[model samples]
Target chain A: MTRLGRSAGRRPSSGFGDAPEVVVEHAGFFSHLVTRSTGRALRMEIEARLARARGAAVAVLDLTHVVMIDYACADEIVAKIVERTGQGGARRVLALLRGVSEHTREPIQRALARRGLAACAEGTGGRGMLLGEIRDRENRAWEEVTRLGRAGTARTTEAVARRLGTGDRQATEALETLTARGLIFGDGSHYVSVAVMARADTSTASADDE
Target chain B: MSRVLSVSPELDHQAFEALVAELPDATRSGVSILFDASAVTWVSPYGLIGLLALGREVEQRTGKRPMLEPPRNREVSGYMERMEFWPAAQNVFQLPGKQARRHGDSGALIEITSIRSNEDVHAVVKKVGEGARRILQGRLGYSKASVIHFSIMLSEVCQNIVEHAGSLGWACAQTYRWQRRLGREVAVLAVMDVGIGFEQSLGARNASTGSAAALEAAVLRGESRFKDRGRGHGLQAIRRQVLEWHGSLRIRSGAAMVGDIAEWERRLAAGAGGEYAPDRVSVKTGLPPFPGAQVMIVLPAAEESITPGPEAA
Candidate 1:
């Protein structure tokens, strides 16, 4: 089984120098998430592990091996995690979902949408997409930024505005919305895809192996 | 002193009323009850679990576990034993002599089981997972995706006992060839609890006149006692899945029963003077009060047939 935490690699610092990433994979532990009790237990376990990772650590929840997830379990596990991570406070964590199959994604998406929240999902091909509630313009901005990596010439807000055919202020708000939702990383001048950051970590691990 | 109640010959949703009408009133004193099943020929999953619920209620109220006269027909007895009905009945009914243990090669997709907590719900889902897939796809000819949806429906119904019912409940599922009712193979799921029924569960938030109104609010309206947005999605999910498969979902709580009757049931119910809404959901109020709730879901066999196989186990 392709475990989520194992794919996190040992080099958490490779992608975002200061902040580390923790992967919480329950595929091996549970074959099905059917009830709220199991979901709460898994969420608590994930929170405990993420707590140790300290400031602004990104948490990836892998659902690859989970054969099924019901709505109650999805609300407790996925929705609760996203809600807690999106809370306004210092030392906040970010949530990302990986290895979500088409069968298991609906309940998770419904759970998130119920709470009026959103999270980034790492697709099978390593690209990131938003799941749950997202504004149309904000989604477009996220797509544009993920395509324009954070390296080399920094793509400023104005560049994105011109690409989107929208005003600079509108573009800025959209990018900021994406940043606030933790779908992408913003450093005042440029935005980077969380998926890209994860990919970089994988590349760094492979290079070190060689 | 003891009272004898005769079990229906064909114990199913249609005969459920007759079975309940035989019950001693809830206020009846400590009089031992003997459930005579000597003439029972067949039992649906709903009837199987409803028997346990009824027995438990009588035992709890009268402070005496009711006695059961097992069905005399060999096939019916064998079928009940294979469904693990005896083991589950031991909890609520007093039986005679040594009973047969459950065999692995039974046709029941999910056996008589308890649903008290989330762990119990998880266990039921896991136990039925593979078997449900095979039966749903191979026998009922559902798509692969429909298998998971079926599991979700199972999980949600069982979870309802834990989250909403104040007490424990029983769940059972089986796939049968309904030669008389529909002339097709249908998967039946039944769950029942002698706990706080829909009236008390939803009356706290949504005002309703009676059990029928409460059931309608919950099943048809998708209302919940909790103010939380996701609290009521389970029933909605069940309703949607049943609609997709053109299945029937019937729920009875307190003094009434409500259901989105299937086409076949609608015609049968029409013959019996059942007034239906434009959407085919029918509600009956002012029924003899029964404690807790009873749910029955029947997923009719696929219209398109490919191959015939052995029944689900």
Candidate 2:
């Protein structure tokens, strides 16, 4: 059984034909997760209802309450929508994200852009919030890697481990793999600044064929 | 005067040592060695770095850097780029020819055009790997790891072609050298094909995602255009390897281009460092236009090896 609920306000719409439309309010990380799981359920329910109603069906993900968003949840929601609508072609999936801040809205916008899905965050009604602090951690790691180069190897590994909340061995292994491939070079001592290695060489012998 | 030195598998090391020994006593005031990589079938970072170290030594002694000829093998070039030694080498040597032109200098070029199926992918990769090992043994007098990661990258790319490139098509790889500059050498490797463009094969994910997204996804390590259950880490792995190793990765798909690591770096340097931006180019497919993907990997000269820190050793 799916828990379907609606925000306060608005009279019962007639077109949906008794398939309860769930309205999502308050977008945070947890809210986003609930919305995604709920969205999946709603999509199935709407499809079933449409089959019974003998009419066209649609799923509207109203992010009017979403205050923030991050990459993982944004990817999950957008990917699900794109997959269902693009592949299934059974229901019209519309995203009504509103009232989100620019900073919070960017990742979703980017994902949408990549999928060729048109969406905009407008005013206070459209804001979506990112949960779990994943984006915050990723940005910090990128910044650290870009600043310290190989000298920051340990720190970068530690930061990534902390961000992913995974074991340190995995992170260290990743770093070692990169080093063996000649992507990041260091003597395994003090960290060299990223400025030197960051200006990597782009031209060589590989550009001949196409 | 440029010279071509061919040695048997057994004499490879002896030949390299002889060359290095001869360097110190050469009558020429400034000696710049230009490796005729066209004839050399394979190479690796360890082998390459050994030769590069010798070149560095020569430069230190005579104030002239030895030059490395571009690799005639695309697989070898890919590996070089991943090591990030290609561009740094460019600072010391002349640039190789652009696109598909044949080498004009007096060196040999090994053309690898025998790739046809998934099985062939393995064979060619192994052949290239062995060839690189042989080259290192003959030219640099050193042997490091036998396993080359580029072989893995090549296998994945070739597998993609075998499984998807639509019908039967062939692949070619070549390497060569330019000239010595500022006491260093520049080498290059170029790979081309006549198959379905990346967009046609990967763009099927979502008609809306288009070819560009497919290309971007291909280079993103974990993203795969295929719905198959296997790890779709081929191109993504290649991209990360290239970036970390100090090389460049360039991809072309029928009028749409994505995955230019150099351009990415420039954007990063310019402080426009969010996600990658798309740039459109006019491309032609083979059915009517020239359709297919051309991947060029450029690597600079290898940096001098730093003495391992006490903590690392």
Candidate 3:
């Protein structure tokens, strides 16, 4: 269910109704030696505009034009943009990432990983992956789902729920999210990450049988 | 009688300019030189290479063979012995220095070693990037972005030594203060190989026929020895980077030599005095050619710079 949280009394912080989307055009070979000051300026613009617009917005950082991104510059630009723009928490702007190539995605992923933040990342070529945190409560759910890999288990929602002590609904959400991010595959009734699937093949054919 | 050119203990790139500065007039004066290495402290790979250039300059101008007075000190001479410096100098001047085995990396100019494979190229690139980064950032004032480009440039040049030369090669880099030309600091990266020459390599790929056309096409047009897509941008990228930094590129292989003297090569076709120099200028020389390709790239101090922040280092 897509429920819209009301922001009548104050500015909507996060995971809410239609927010303003800002496009940040990336330029050049985006290098560690080349930190874009404009990224910081864009975050400030969001902060200042949100204070005036008096509501929440989602800032989609468009890096389609950026040729290359090294690790250090990626951290300098993206992490600060995410943390300073009120996307660090709720009641401010949220940061979403789009137009990442395999070349650019690595450094961006490393930067987000270092900050313990997550943003929706997608390349212009249609591959999307999740990194850092998801705004919803199912943010850390994938850890338990991937942990099932060590036991060499191919699990259904019920099995994962039983193993992780989460409700069936939570397990289903976790499995669905993991599948969407291409981290796991769903074979009709069972969910299996690659290692778990490999182990399942040797241990029991039950995954295929079911 | 040959004039004696005293060799400093430190015959590094830092001293190369001042050493080379008097050479043009000295060689023009048409005197064979006696390169005295008696009181030398150390000689980097680039320094040895510089010594080779000095020999070539003297021979190319006066046709008189210069001789070397090897360092009297046992340690300095041994260092040269380990570097195979004498033989390398002998290659240019036809002097008397023993030909020994080219040894491993000695931390002088990204190591004085032969590149055998892609792994060697990567190792050299990593070492050059790490060791030279401080010089580029602090001294030459290139942004980190430019430094990455330089890394790619170095890798491409070194990789060429393996892929195209078809023979073992040597690569080295050093930062020097250019008091004469630009009067600022510059970083010079030189890669040389004693293998099948450019004309042969390009001809083998069915790209061009002769040494002149092949040398011109390979360096100027960035044409590769393979007819594959997404390949052969090393020299071209280096050329563009040199343009951006207002640097220079000089390349000599086989019987054909092309030099762009706008720091040595420039962005536009213009070489020096606003005269249009083609991407490559083939000079026919009678001097016996080196067995492989030899390229020297000079990146001048950046015209524009930012005050590096505390975290910049």
Candidate 4:
């Protein structure tokens, strides 16, 4: 079970409900991330913060303020974190990139693609998009979930299966795959997008192994 | 008696080989060498850094500072001084008289700077980034994105010296007007070191593979001496960006050189019957054995600013 503990009595103004999301704002910390050593330093700081949070927490890496990021920094920070997050350690931290720009996205994409890993990023209009490798079925399922969010759907397996016009088993497999990759979170029978998790009220937010 | 070697009139990438070829074998000990640059009329960034490396090599081997006869041409000497060459050279060359004071409009985009650690690389980027907007954007017509790429490229090249060379090195950049030939401005960047080169750094098995094969493996195939996943991407990315910009890049280590020669350079080479026509394998090899690596990058002006010169007719 995933329980949120760091609720600082502050509610998110984005109206998606205040989930106890750990936001690691990097723009204020670094002007640019260009070298391997600098990347390693930032990665360690992010890892330390993730380790402090309770089980199965979603961490938003806000890159809006960073000026530039080179390949070394991208590989050292983003790729390493994605690789480690997928390892399913005692404390699982899912990463969601926020405020990625055209200049910074290329290196991040290349870094993740090289390792055959993928991470969810906040796209335009607060929707979620995959940044690295993804299969067609997985992508379709993710798109369906985000599409349902347009109408305030709960993103349950049965709802996704009805939308994809596929049977419940295939849809369940797709959602489960996304959840395993940390692109989405599974709560018993329903899946929640990271976009929602970033704002969901932690008092009611609970993710289960299913 | 000290050995005397005359410097080439036009010091460049190709001339560096001729310079090194004049050195005595590594086994010759305790014989101080004198570099007579009294006749050198012009020098490229490669030539400048290569001289430092050569001086360091001689000093380390002979345990005595190499004696350098300053260039006789006042213009050449002035150019060197303004580029901050004398300050760096003081560490490697022994002058006969008082060191000349440097005061002038330095034509260099980035002055000769030593690369000993990562902080040096950061300083280079910061120093160059300040003036790169005016030079790369205003003169060369490079877009903002291109300027950023150039900074990253510069950072990676300097990092190679820190990460791979295992010794000290120097880096410099200057803008040159190819008025007679290309009628365009090109930014020339050179980075050189006196340390373990590709053949030794790659591993024991590659020790005998020679510099050409090792350069080909590293630059073209992106093979690194390290087995890490992200290792060796710098050179490959540099090659791609240089090609996309229609520029020229050459790397020389040990006794061989490998390069992506631009079309204009190839034409000039063919016209002059130069050894670097890219037609023969031996052309890239058979240079005098030298330690460490020397890299040269020439980025031409963007297409909008390019125009054929009188020589083109």
Candidate 2 residue-wise lDDT, A1-210, digit = tens: 223222322212222223233122212222222112233444455444434422212233444444333333354454344333322221222233334444345445544544434332234542222212233433333334434433444566776567556678865664443333222333353222212221122122111111
Q: Could you list the iRMS of every candidate?
A: 1.2, 16.1, 12.5, 1.5
lDDT of 3 by residue, B235-263 (tens): 66566666666666767776566665552
Evaluation by DockQ, superior candidate among 2 and 3: 3
Clashing pairs in 4: A17-A199, A18-A200, A18-A201, A19-A200, A19-A201
Question: Could you tell me the C-alpha RMSD of candidate 3 in Å?
Answer: 18.7
* Ranking of all candidate structures by their DockQ, best first: 1, 4, 3, 2
Superposed by TM-score, candidate 3 places the C-alpha of residue A147 at a distance from the truth, in angstroms, of 31
Listing candidates in order, what is each one's chain A TM-score? 0.78, 0.33, 0.47, 0.75
Writing each residue's lDDT as its tens digit, candidate 4 over A51-122 gives 765445656666666666777777887877877653453245677777777767777887788778888876
Which digits, one per residue and each the tens of the lDDT, describe model 4 over residues B124-217? 8777775788888888888887767787788778888887899999999998887755777889999999889887777644555877788778
TM-score of each: 0.88, 0.34, 0.45, 0.84
Chain B TM-score against the true chain B, each candidate:
0.92, 0.49, 0.63, 0.90
Model 1 interface DockQ: 0.68
Off by over 4 Å in 3: A1-210, B1-47, B50-111, B263-288, B304-313
Candidate 3: chain B TM-score equals 0.63
Model 3 TM-score, 2 decimals:
0.45
Give one digit per residue, the lDDT tens place, for model 2 in B196-216: 666677665646354556566
* Model 3 lDDT, full chain set: 0.55
- TM-score preference between candidates 2 and 4, better one: 4
